[model samples]
Target: MRRTLLLLIGVFLASCQSGKDQKEDVKQEPMRTPEARKEVVYQVFTRLFGNTKTANVPWGTAEQNGVGKFSDFNEKALAEIKDLGVTYIWYTGVPHHALIQDYTAYGISNDDPDVVKGRAGSPYAVKDYYNVNPDLADDPAKRLEEFKALIDRTHAAGMKVLIDIVPNHVARNYEGKTNPNGVEDFGAQDRTHMEYHKDNNFYYIPGSAFAVPNWEGGYQPLGGEKNPLSDSRFKEVPAKWTGNGARSVQPGMNDWYETVKVNYGVRPDGTRDFPDLPEGYEYKGYQAHADFWADKELPNSWDKFRDIAEYWLDMGVDGFRFDMAEMVPVEFWSYMNSAIKLKNPDAFLLAEVYNPDLYRAYIRKGKMDYLYDKVELYDSIKHIVKGYGWTDHIPVVQKGLKDIEHHMLHFLENHDEQRIASPDFAGKAELAKPAMVVSATISTSPTMIYFGQEVGEPGKEQAGFGSPTRTSIFDYIGVPHHQRWMNEGAFDGGQLSAEEKSLRDFYKRLLNFTINSPALMGEYQDLHFFNKELNAKYDHRILTYARWSTGEELLVVTNFDEKKSYQLDLKVPQELLRKWKLSPGKYSLEEQLYGSVKSELLVPAGGAGEFRIELQPLESRIFKLLRP
Candidate 1:
């Protein structure tokens, strides 16, 4: 009799704890206003977006492998992108960067091939902050005007424009030829003899001259092409630190030797030369941060970057995609971002910060609108899609980031990541369906897609200075799948294969629903954990969740298994049923993504709600509950 009583009491306590957890799960604050739409960013590599060239010759020049001009993004193209549910078009590699091609006629000096990554050059190595890349314009001298026209066209198509702002470094031969009046170039007023100074733009090694890295692994500039600038020589009187902070005159082959690191008032001893933020500043808004820095003395590099950002804002650019932001100090971001917010309060400040520890600091104190959620969500999804990991880890990851979930941007493909269709990854774009659904709708943060992600660009070309698997940001090569969508500049999917078209249609439906759903901007509760415990058939390959607002309730489920279909009973915790005020009745469950499927949700008196779901391999569904 005593043993029976103890067992019964333990079971009752367990049920009560489970109910309490479910109640707490749905108590999160909404990410934004109920009426606000989620942002979808489309990152297009500007020079390669419209290039229809089939000649993907290794180390090919712009003429051989035809480059896409800014004119390529015509009204038709912009409209098509907008129709894909993109709210922002990130025109990557727009700024004037160091390239091997000769633009001396336009008063632009040729960058040494030894320092340039490819004939096209790395976009991170900004050569002229005030000018646009000459290669992107039909008329080289009118590059900035062409970019401005592109920005205007993007806005006219109902999408904002985003461009790169590489604050951590610049090209080794940076020359601000088109700088605005009263503005001087970086390092112009530097005290070169000193290694570090608050006023100096770059850190120097007092007694050494810059030397080219020793090419190894058979790697050479332009694949050993004989050019005057490729003679293994670059003239710098006093060697400055390499872009990746390599404090050597001769950086290794793997180091970022082509660019020089920009110093932001931090000494070699790790002491800050700038003023620190006041206590309680992290919880404050951008306006308060800006006010705090208004009367303080800042570094010269800080002032220069602020001017560059403000100049672009004046020219109608909506926001920036800061590169390698974590390497730079958060204090610098607080100062710079606050200034940007002061000018354009609605500016989208997305940063490439990979450190999980710095995520909150960058978003809170640094005032960043979004930080790349690469370290957590993207990695977890990649592992699961590749069939090596379980879906159960996702909820744990989300729980860890619950406080700042809305600030972490999600992406499956970016310029730096391998293509989903590449052999190194899932090897098929279809395999990423479930992952994409979860990533876009799992949080209220923004969703970003690379240029050819929808069409499953494998990025297998061996373009010079870049390997297979990932798209080459350094070479002048045409993106094959993206080019098919370009369809001879028709901006239609006239040449896309049937499979590609289907994949693209899937993306369109998913993205459009995300931007239009109020539930996505509302409270979320994890059904995955609940189902895992209550449903006998629920497995680690499946994930389910609930999102709801005033009049909307969504049950999202995904099957990551590419080989198996599931017929399982998915459960909604008792506390969730109570919160929904759903009392012992059958509800209509309609699919929102494809709109061709429906399921039944049955709630029994004194029990959890049940969803009899049939999920196919690599499939995802967003079901809406009809209360009738």
Candidate 2:
């Protein structure tokens, strides 16, 4: 009787479940893909962005000159950043690193002053791979939650997040306190005595203890602060190699003394210990790359970093900007990046590789999406801005890097570069207008600007670790010009002078156009040759170039000469006209950048198109061709 009752109940439950399943058979939502748009990365130093203190005190602690927290990146600040047309925000100094500040009360260990760089330590010297800097948190215990909330807020504002991933080296006191279950720290499973093990996290000299370097240049850790751990001594059995590849027991003061080099299956004899990338693997997808490693044995360090990166990605971080990527072997990047992409295909991978010869190898094999164009494009533009290089050389650089031009990221100022308005650089912010135009419009590559660059932040502060010219990344300091725009977190630019406001407005216009223009990502044609021949009055300081796509075209011309204005009658070549198939007629050429200038383009019968331009000193004109 009981069995009969159970059978009847089961039949009734099954009938109800079938009805609910029918309701769930609706149309499935389409999978979303990442949008294809020109990227503009705004690199903001997280600790310094929202700080309103303008004490300008040299070697000051966080108390004397307040530090910016993660909470400071409020909706107003992010909205203002979006207004400036930033697609990605590279929040510098996100990872937890060795610092002089004492966070022992939060169950975090204290870093010795002898091994730390400044009051706010070097961001590159990462100490905990699983956590963010407690200094950036509102409450030290909820640092990770705070960062995750920031990521959510950033996505809400229509911008992606990018943070540094220093794979080449780590802090001298590297630890992973917040690592997940079953995950080990970097050196936990290593054989330290071998010094050449394929699985060891760091290269070490057996039987030697690490020593602190002799102080020089009147500089000391914490500026010779009176502390118990500031005794200018550090102890590490079997001294590891320094970040700059110094294998000495004691590295020099000028070397990267606070950090130790990470080993990536490379031997001390300069030969790879792991499997080499297969030939003709340049264009393979990430799945193929990841599959190649499925059966193969990789070094433990590679797996460890891959896990660390996946951890961040799983925690809602979008991408990484690798620091000193060349220091690590390319094979390791192949393994690590492939694993990352296998998880999330849209992860943006950018690297800092200065060697021009290694650019293609890193991009094709290592799967890097973008590289810094500092040595080639940035150096050429800086020379021109300083009245040294010629505009003719600019076109040559553009052509020389034509194959990988889109992969090269252009920037005028970063954390490591000189500020545009500094005396050591251009001395006047107006001098950068022409260069900024060229840098933004001259290529298909993404353009980056430092945090305070738009408002002309001359980094003339005598901060602790570094002097003026560039903002101090190692010190706890405030940026005066950027603070005026911060306006006590209102982000309204209320205190900016008229000149500063005009400069910022120009930046806004240029950046907005860069992300929206279709012709910028199109094909390029040099107009200098035809312009020089058609008009004898064409000045050498003036540069002319054309970019076009189907139904859209742009004519970009700039005056590099800061002291002279030029009246140019630039002619579009017949070959380009034939390629564009532009008929013999008059067309309107509107300046798209500032939206204040308009002119006419005359295309006569069976001849070239001629456009008259009146360029002022430090002027850049991006004229879009439109049908009349």
Candidate 3:
């Protein structure tokens, strides 16, 4: 009787399950991808990073001084950033800057607190790569802890962190001593250690004045209106020092940066008249920091440099944004890459090689994972939008990708370049949302968003080397007043415009799409771009291109013509893409859909209403193939 009852119950349950299963069929959602695939950045100038001072120490002036302590970083503002869904937060000027006796290299102290006019100079002049600039070290070790923690939070929340590092130059503010392992003092000692020489500096051109700072108005020009590099006059008065192989190298062995110009020679015993040591030890430059081979002295400098990098990584550095990485010897990078890989293989090493043309040089060298795609920005402005002529450029864009196997790190704005609102980035008269949106999704390398980029960061001209230089005025432009932007001194406060909010949200949405879309993350999808032919007449304008990743294939078509759409068709891998093309007759890509979709299709300009896919005159789109 029990068996009979069980059989009946089972039959009833099976009948109900069958009925429920027929009701509705659901498709499983695709795996969510990380932000790295279509990354964006929020760049912060450390001096102008946030609102509050690092520590409670008084900096002497509210607007003029640099952020005081290493521990004072703004958190409230960062919280909002977390929501924006950007992948990277790059901090510039974290290490101490260069300084003369006291005054900042430039005297124009305006709205920024981290300027530290009389404090340290700019972050570019790296005094000690290991020492965190005291101004930004709000919580000392805790600050770094929080920094790395921020990366963790970012990654957990879907993001990455990158910090700027200057490898080519040392801050004049370093305080390290001349003895073994050198104890760092900062700014004052920085002046005593940092020097500029033409030749020994470039590695390629050490003391040849090869790197004359193109002192635009923002920076102090090299002395005598002549770069210590350009003019050899400065080399006449070199410092006479004993340690660090100061004199062992040939007179012209080091660059101007390495040789310090001294007022007088000093003896090791504290006497005014110093003696000549191993070689004809003349005071070519003094107080000018220089490095020597392992045979010269202080066999630990290289290790120290490495240690600085390791310290940051261990302290929570997600990645390093190397400053002037091109100038650093390739051998050093080989060591860096090997070591960094051993420490953390995923650690990102983004070199600041602003020139896209120079991309190969840096990539060939080890230790680098990414570099700027400046050419794209230039093309986006001059040809893609301005349409000065090279109207339908597709080939050029394609060739640019030959060197890169994966994606490229693309950007429209950063600390060094104009923000999105800058004239160059303003592109067309209309809001080219489609253009930018498509670019963000389709570009080869990952994307980096400038700090104020999402919200349409405003730019205002301040003094740069006595001339006016424009920068983002987040406080003046669209922003809402908050403590982080106001009295607490955490960040530049401002209200967000409707456009900014919408743009920001749209970007977030786009990221969300990429994260969840199986079509986008596909490795089989290939990248494509529209560049003018090599021998074509007007080669300067128009950068039309596309990238196919995963299931979604992207094509970016821009009418650099500023006013009109430079209409064009695409060249696809017919053999591969044609397999999925519409039939020869009555074939057409109607609206967003075509007659019949296939695994691959080459929509060239024409075929029974087919083959060629027509791009809107001034717009672009990323096509996701729905395999039939």
Considering every candidate listed, which one attains the maximal TM-score? 1
- TM-score (all chains, Cα) for each model: 0.95, 0.93, 0.60
User: For candidate 2, lDDT tens digit of each residue in 1-628?
Assistant: 1122333323322321112111112221112123334789999999999888988678898988889999999898999999898999999999999998889998889998888888899999999999999999999999999999999999999999999999878999997898899998988877888777988999999988999999988888777769888887888998998887778999988778899988877777666666766765556768888888888877788888898899999988889999977667776788889998888888988998776756776777788888999889999888888888877778888877777788899999999888999998898888999899889988878899999999999999988886799999989999988999998888999999898898999999999998887777777888876677778888567789998666678999999888898887789877787887888888899999877888888888877878888999988999999875
lDDT of 1: 0.89
Where does model 1 exceed 4 Å of error?
Answer: 1-31
Looking at model 3, report the run of 10 residues with the lowest lDDT sum. Answer: 280-289
* Leading candidate by lDDT: 1
Error of 1 at 494 (Å): 1.0
lDDT (C-alpha, whole model) for all candidates: 0.89, 0.84, 0.41
Ordered list by TM-score, greatest first: 1, 2, 3
- Candidate 2 has its poorest 10 consecutive residues by lDDT at 15-24
Q: Give per-residue CA lDDT, model 1, range 314-429, as digits (tens).
A: 99999999998877788889989999999999999999877676676777778899999998999999999999999989999998889888889999999989899999999999
- Candidate order, lDDT descending: 1, 2, 3
TM-score quality measure for candidate 1? 0.95
For model 3, give the RMSD to the true fold. Answer: 19.4
**Backbone clashes in model 1, listed as residue pairs:** none
Error of 2 at 424 (Å): 1.6
